[model samples]
Target: MLSFLEGHTSEVCACAWSPAGSILASGSGDSMARIWTIADVMSRSSLQNEHSSVVVLKHVKGKTNEKNKDVTTLDWNKFCSAPPASYPSGMGCASCGHVKFKAGSARHGVFRVEGRLLATGSYDGQARIWSTNGKLKSILNKHKGPIFSLKWSKKGDYILTGSVYKTAIVWDVKAEEWKQQFEFHSGPILDVDWRNNVSFATSSSDNMIYVCKFGESHPIKTFSGHQKVVLLFLFSFSSGKKGDMWVSAKHYFVWAKLTVSNGTPTGSLLASCSDDITAKIWSMKQDKYVHDLREHAKEIYTIRWSPTGPGTNNPNKQLLLASASFDTTVKLWDVDQGRLICSLNGHRGPVYSVAFGPNGEYLVSGSLDKSMHIWSLKECKIVKTYPGSGGIFEVCWNKEGNKIAASFADNTVCVLDFRM
Candidate 1:
């Protein structure tokens, strides 16, 4: 369940999975993107000569094999596609390793389009598409600044990306082109989410969340309350006939449902982190504050709900909630009762991201201290701390709940196998 790949000399920033769930795609600050198979990286002791960069010039008539081998004289096609599957694999131009890991000031972030299609945003102001099998699909060169975040819709037919240049765009998967451009915040768009095709929300350094519908040039509603720049915004869904719920964080954290239907949130319940060091839940429909759950002594950086329904023992009890903070701890809470359930500690630095594992029996978290920790719900303690690539900024759990993808501030991404 614990393994480390030291392929990136700098920081590994982003990690993603393929449709088949066998391969992992990672982007690094070394200006290289790599494809690692789960069996290859985990089962084997080493991958010798696997991270080669030699460009192979295949010939049809006569030529030397660039793979340190000599071959019969053959004719070579001067123009062929699919660059050599190198150490780090990501989208970049054919001539220069634009997507390869580089030194200072390079753009880096990775997102999955479909289950297999992967996209990377670079400081080079381009978004590159690739297949999960380590093949470059296309390069998007329309953006003028670093692409900070990228996401695919539920159906995987479209793409949404946020930029440091203060804008977010939606792309058409079929045409491989920009479909819509949304401009609202004056500062860089830090994060964005597409809510089941019904609506989308964006966070910004300008301390705002802009909600917009598809094809609309302007935001339908704007949520402004944070005193500092909003760093992340996430939307969640339930089975009932209601819209999506949104969770947003900045200097504060807030959650709300956009609209309401039949006493349920037709929209979403919105929540936010407060400078007061408490997380507040709000009713978007009622425009009234629900409850201010104050527990953390420091600022709450992140919050997430359990994937499972409310506890079976107390179906009427409020749902379970998890929150991380600068206090160097993560805490679980009963949102309905507004009481602390358990305190999870041991992180040395600020805990940036926390997530419930696939089985809900465990939780995973990433910390600025350069580690990912897997905690046991049964024991309510740190079970293990998986070393990180750089300063872990985010940790993502795939749909299957087997792999954990961690993004670092150093621009590298790491994938941890949870099989153990």
Candidate 2:
């Protein structure tokens, strides 16, 4: 731990790591959010505390606030992943300007992947964009209620936002206008995720999941088969499956379950988890279980593959799979070997999210026990931990793997500087 960040006069509500790991932005009950820089944290000379041996990470950026409303949540623009220009490939919004806008209450914030624009949603019933340096960009005023979720396209050309108004909107960034809006949800939309640049999936309080595409007035596919939110869906005959939670005759559809996902665009391979107490990777070639990832003694609830997989981001990338189980362990697997590489243990409760850093050098997991662990794949050990906080709802790494963000029950967000 660098010195404990102490500026949030209240429970921190939400935090997000920038697209690059240089900055960590956290929101709190104080109606404030602060951005901290990793370079500033690392460059400081070490000094011993008068009271204890633990090193404290100091906050370089002061508390950032708007309107004295509890900051709710935020996200990083994950779209600008173009390797590198003249500078480094992954430094995020910290390099932009610094300006804050007063709003009703911030519900979420996201940076453009190119690290040029930032968007924030507030209870004021608006979504806004700004320059990376915090200069005001534009205000997207359409949703009549608070915006809860936002996702930028991989191409960085479009933005998606879901709101409490039972609607989701897609905005065209280049034109500075909203191109399409979805209002079919019977209740407030709870979450929105992009399947690709052109298609997305939305889950609503109406107990439905809809697959929508750009410019479509109606959903291309609607899923009403689950009693609860389905985090991910997988299809494959190449890997393995055991539980009867779901079954499909051909391809394109399968049983959906809790956390764990990452799919190729062509649907050549699929990975998913279920109540069957197993982690299975199914493929198109065999249409059955190819490798049964087993080790956790309890139900495996979450799984995630390295974003830079064999066919996607990295051409020569090593295929890796990670799974979090009720057994209080996070296991890393060598997909090619069909073997469990190692298991990480430290959390005292069910793990909620398991994410692989974009570079595939580290893996992070958050749990109900209010702890976040960063494990080094090279060392196969728990490297650092941001101990003790409200139960974490989710954890994610920026594209460069330099920083991380976690959402908590305390209504706070914590961003930690990571070195892997």
- Backbone clash total, candidate 2: 31
Residue-level lDDT of model 1, residues 1-420, one tens digit each, is 444444554455556555545556566555556665555344322223232222111111254223312111110011112233432545553422234333343443322222445566666556666654456666666777777777665545566777878888887766879888888889987676665454667777786777778867788777765666566555533222243344444422223222235544333644455444666554344333355667788877778765543222222323456888999999887544557899998899998888877556788999999999998876899887877547886676765777776767664445566764
Q: What is the per-residue lDDT of model 2 for residues 1-420, given as tens digits with 9 covering 90 to 100?
A: 332444555666455566544556665556444554544353222222221121112211265334434444455555543322423322332433222222342512322333445566665556666544455566677888767667666656677888878999998866778989998888777566665678766656564656688878898765453333333433222222222222111101222221223432332334444434555554333435556665778666666666544344553556666777677888887654668888787889988777778776788898889999888888888888776557776677777766676767665455555764
- Residue 62 of model 1 has an lDDT of 51
User: How far is 181's C-alpha from truth in model 1 (Å)?
Assistant: 1.1
- Counting clashing residue pairs in each candidate, in order, gives 53, 31
Worst 10 residues of 2 by lDDT: 244-253
Alpha-carbon local distance difference test for all models: 0.59, 0.57
> Worst ten-residue run, lDDT, model 1?
71-80
Q: Model 1 compared with the native: what TM-score?
A: 0.71
Cα RMSD to the true fold for all candidates = 12.8, 10.5
